[model samples]
Target: MVPILDYLLQRQISPQWRGLLTALAEEFETQIGQGELRQLMYRVGCRFAAAAPLPPCSSTADLADALNACWQETEWGYVELSDEPEYLRIAHSCAPLLGFGAAALSWTPAFLEGVYQTWLSALGAEGLSVVQASEFDEHATIEFRLGRHPV
Candidate 1:
């Protein structure tokens, strides 16, 4: 496990803050709807990617290293990228989205989708799209696929 993540996992969140976050998540969903909230979060993620741009990577390994470094710094999860016949498969794990409460989990993964999409686009994958392909699993991992959108 990453040292920062290990420390974070060891720390406990206060119940008051947890309840507040839960209420805020429920309010956001109630006011904006899940889809719109996801879009908003996606934009927020785009901004994050822009703020902490990755250096140019000449290969997939380099890209992975760069991404891991960024994730380590941000304490966001780590990712595993695999080349597939049709698309690039991204398995991201250990994200702290659960800190926002269960309600937020339904939409917060879109933020990661946006972050990856923007980062890959900046890396010259102009026509590829990054989309969440699975929900958070037991390990707080989510799957994303990067490929051209179907017609």
Candidate 2:
């Protein structure tokens, strides 16, 4: 059962969208720069979160479940949330952003940052911020941290 589920989760993005995202990444990077492209993608993510707000959740597990439902519905991948003394650690795996091509990687994770920031803020995590903590690992997973706003 776990193997089958892993297979499903590892499904690749469709070639059509992959090509389009790759091209768009190139164009955006060439025209507006990677920083600007990241900001744009972040806004796109914020809009996505706005369109699909999660249900009220009282516990970390419940919140993870709600977030997983959203990810599964969109085939965007799933996240594991861990409670830490200082912040929430978010490990997101199998995101379709990889399909945007290697060049897109430098900025695409910002999209997830934006998505999580909005969602967490909506959950009453005011005064906190979500930021990428690490780059994509070999398994295409990325790490994010949600904590008090940086000085």
Candidate 3:
């Protein structure tokens, strides 16, 4: 997700990328579904960011400019934010740069030993920061810090 969106931003900047994206997407949809497509997309995206998972930029302007060309290309097209799916919430929440970057639902303690560990591990490896808070007396609000970021 975060990785894929990052890739999408990067891809959008290039001239020949739309066709490349179309080809990649069609291949995925034909060979996979949303789940698998997401996994594959993230895998491909991580490669591009491998050189520097995080870079020290002097100001927000630098980051904005750095992202503008790419963002305008991929995200320049209209997006229907009002219509979103379940996974949309998860992707948006856990992705690196979104405003709401994480939400943890309360489950049996056993669940944490499984899903949480795996997810947190991957997120940490990717340099996302985590924040947690108890939710609705049952669930918890666990998220990654998206704005100020983490070193």
The candidate that achieves the highest lDDT relative to the unseen native structure: 2
Lowest lDDT block of 10, candidate 3:
87-96
Alpha-carbon shift of residue 34 in model 1 (angstroms) = 1.1
TM-score of each: 0.87, 0.91, 0.32
Question: Candidate 2 vs candidate 3: which has greater TM-score?
Answer: 2
For model 1, residues 1-151, the per-residue Cα lDDT tens digits are 4556545643544455667777888889778988898999899889989998999999888888999999988777699988899899999988877767766888989889989998999999998899899998766679999998785
Better of 1 and 3 by lDDT: 1
The regions of model 2 sitting more than 4 angstroms off are 1-11
lDDT of candidate 2? 0.86
What does candidate 2's lDDT look like per residue over 89-142, in tens digits?
999988877677777889999999999999999999999999899998767689
Candidate 3 deviant stretches above 4 angstroms? 1-24, 52-55, 69-151
Judging by TM-score, tell me the better candidate of 1 and 3: 1
Candidate 1, residue 106: how far the Cα is off, in Å: 1.0
Task: Please give the ranking of all candidate structures by TM-score, highest first, separated by commas.
Answer: 2, 1, 3
lDDT of 3: 0.32
